[model samples]
Target: MNEPAAPAAPETLEVPVAALRPSLEAVLMVADQPLDSVSLASVVGHPVETVVAALQLLAEEYDEQDRGFELRHVAGGWRYYTREAYAAVVEQLVLEGQQARLTQAALETLAVVAYQQPVSRARVSAVRGVNVDGVMRTLLTRGLVQEAGQDAETGANLYRTTRYFLERIGVSSLDELPELAPYLPEMDDLEDELERVGGLPRTPDAVQDHPAVEPMTDSQETP
Candidate 1:
């Protein structure tokens, strides 16, 4: 009887290839943060090519659907973020009262720090044509800027933007900052002033100092 045809060689189960793309999209949609390709592949137990292909498909699908959110590569990984068209709506909901509106002075100070990071407080003040001691303190308190290190020449504290700055600006990194060519004259002037001072000086105690330094607040008390 040919031993029942060798038991007909037990059948092996097959996984559906079409399900890969949807599975990857689901994972990305649910993740709270960006996911690296390698990490995603490891978690999904799939080849890198398969994962990449799936991600591209998902991104295209969102684009075609005109969804309010999309998958983007950011911070060296992929993340789902609200589309720019719906930024205002999302901002209204998630950032209500949480985001402080930036003052003109604060914006200027932030621009200086962003471009000339690892710069000294004295430098930032010189660039803004105003004392930034208070503004810098406000930024520090808000977690927008931090002491990157000490300036080797003058032992002054070197400051730089934090990850929060990137998040607030919706950029992956400082490299995304707009080209300054159109506004170079003004920026250059600020840089020159900072260089002249060798560094920004600590404000004298006589300056009207406010104890509660809040960043991006329109109603900050003048020190």
Candidate 2:
């Protein structure tokens, strides 16, 4: 048999020293999602350490210069975001009916998922007293919610918030979510509201034995 072909030579790059930052900037300007340092280093033909240092310097320079936008490392990657101090200015322009904001229903559904995930749509419906199938689809399409796995007993698909959700909400982790359980309605109130707002009338069995959402629990931690 013919000997295995010699491995192809590693690709060579000769990016000019002065062009490193500009070249990185150009690539990032068109990126729709965050790009990690390894990807950036590969593209710029630089060592990973060098690329990371350059990115950090660029981030600092932007902060020192008080730029309109600042580089951020979010969700395991780097991207540019409008500085928080100027959010009102950017929001004024971006929210002028040009971009669609999440509906109130969507927002409510999202909150339920963020707190109660990995939860099933049936449980969310029970909690909200309305069908959540449509709302779940919208969240999935928006990359805010994703299917986690099947519920062990019911076999229903469970859902959880994505890293993109954390990024959008400006939190580093799920544990950073605010403590709102104390303010939520009691379980009795929820059961009453569910019935009043068009949820299934619970039999005595469901009221006692159903594995529905508990009064927003403080002990539930992200997996």
TM-score of each model, paired residue for residue: 0.43, 0.46
lDDT (Cα) of model 2: 0.77
Where does candidate 2 stray beyond 4 Å? 1-99, 194-223
Question: Which 10 consecutive positions of candidate 1 have the poorest summed lDDT?
Answer: 206-215
- Across residues 103-129, which tens digit of lDDT does each residue of candidate 1 receive? 677778888889878777666655555
The residue-level lDDT of candidate 1 at 72 comes to: 95
Per-candidate total of colliding backbone pairs: 2, 0
lDDT for model 1 comes to 0.70
Q: Residue by residue across 188-221, what tens digits does model 2's lDDT show?
A: 7766876554444556566534555423332322
Worst 10 residues of 2 by lDDT: 214-223
